[model samples]
Target: MKKKNVISVVVTVVAVIVAVYTLFPFYLVLMNSFKNANDIVASPVSFTGVNVTQWITNLSNVINNSNFNFWYAFGTSLAITVISLILLALFGSMAAWVICRNKTKWSTAIYMTFIASMIIPFQVVMLPLISTFRDVGEFIGVSMLQSIPGIVFAYCGFGGAMTVFILTGFIKNIPYELEEAANIDGCSPEGIFFRVIFPLLKPVITTVTILNGMWIWNDYLLPSLMLGQNGRVKTLPVAVQAFVGSYVKQWDLILSAALLAIVPMIIIFLFAQKQIMHGMVEGAIK
Candidate 1:
């Protein structure tokens, strides 16, 4: 009994230390965002001279600055994320359902191909990706670079592998018996999927949505390359970089912009954390 109590205390102490280590950077950013550049440089670790008015000033300056276009960037990011996630969920679920139900060499091969594709680093394909987008844009007479649709397409492709991977695992655990019974009741494959399987996928779908949503929201490199530095289209991260450059790296404004960029994602995770964890565990176990 004494040994178990000692182990418990040690584990608790380690967990607390790890938690503080993980959150310390975020704490620093929150603390210094409310201070001027000079004050931040003078004492970054201490909030001794921070003021509420400074927080308002810093945030206002970031949001109101024409270069940053905080509201416009926010709208653009929201639209892209929403559109991409919707498409990913629909397509990924459909693909996973088909793959799960079909017991064929082709389906197995295709699933393996997706799994293999996940291992390929983005850097390896990024140049070709850009070139292909450019070429395709010219051939199609619709822009595929520096456009919302183009970015959405890119995200769908990149996010598809993992989405299908997770959903496929979860769907496998769903008994084939339900689908068989639904078919006997005169339901088409589409009906079985939409009315039956898809409804039951809520937990895992929530998991994939949160996972992909966070990635698409905070992604910087893909957006940076797809939407040029000075392009009219900008996500929050890209816009923050542009804003920082215009301000000549003024830390207060930069940190404020960083804080603003993360607020939406933080809110989303806070609300959905339970669902995310549940879905992940269910998918893994089944």
Candidate 2:
């Protein structure tokens, strides 16, 4: 009993330490956001100069600045993220179902291809991706380099592999008997998938949406590359960079913008975190 108690206490203490370490950066950002540049420069970690008026002033500066049009950026980010998640969830589940149901060498090869692509980092293909998109956009007579649809399309492609991977694992464990029964009932393949299979994917779909939402919302590199830093269309992450200058860095405005950008994702995670865990564990186990 004593040995178990000693180990449990040690584990709890370690977990608490890790939690604090991970959250310390966020704490600093939040704390410093409520202080002026002088107070932040004097002692960033200190709580002495924290005030609500400074907080409002900083946030107002970020919001009202022409460079950081918060509302427009927020809308662009929301549209791209929401549209991308919907498409990924729909197409990913459909592909996973088809792959899981088929028992051919081709299906296995395609699954392996997706898994292999996951190992390749985005940096490896980013430049190529840009040129390809530019050429294709010109060929097709549509602007793919600096558009919302272009970014959403890129997200779907980048996010597709992992979405299919997770859903495939979970689908593999779903009893084929359910699908077989639907087939015997004279349902079409499309009907079987949409009416039967897709409904059962809610929990896992929510998981991928949240996962992809956080990534797409917080992503800076892809958006920065596709949508130029000073582009008319900008996501929150891209717009936040406006506070930073070549020589003069606005720490107060930067942190305030960072705070605004993260608040939505934090609210979402707090609410759907349970679903995320449940879906992940179930997908892995089954």
Candidate no. 1 TM-score: 0.90
Q: Cα lDDT of model 1 overall?
A: 0.91
Per-residue lDDT of model 1, residues 1-286, tens digit only:
9999999999999999999999998898899998998998898898777999999999999899888989999999999999999999999999999999999999999999998998899999999999999999999999999999999999999999999999998899999999999999999999999999999998788888877887798899999999988899999989988887888758898888889988887787688788766765654554
| TM-score for candidate 2, residues paired by index | 0.88
- CA error at residue 217 for candidate 2, angstroms: 1.8
Q: What is the C-alpha lDDT of each candidate?
A: 0.91, 0.88
Q: Candidate 2: deviation at residue 263, Å? A: 1.4
Which sections of candidate 2 miss by over 4 Å? Answer: 1-18, 277-286
Best by TM-score: 1
- lDDT per residue (tens digit) for residues 1-286 in model 2: 9999999999999999999999999999899999998889889888978999999999898888888889899999999999999999999999999999998999999999999998899999999999999999999999998999999889989999999998998788889999889999999999999999999988788778767777898899999999989988999988887546521566888888889888887887788788766755654453
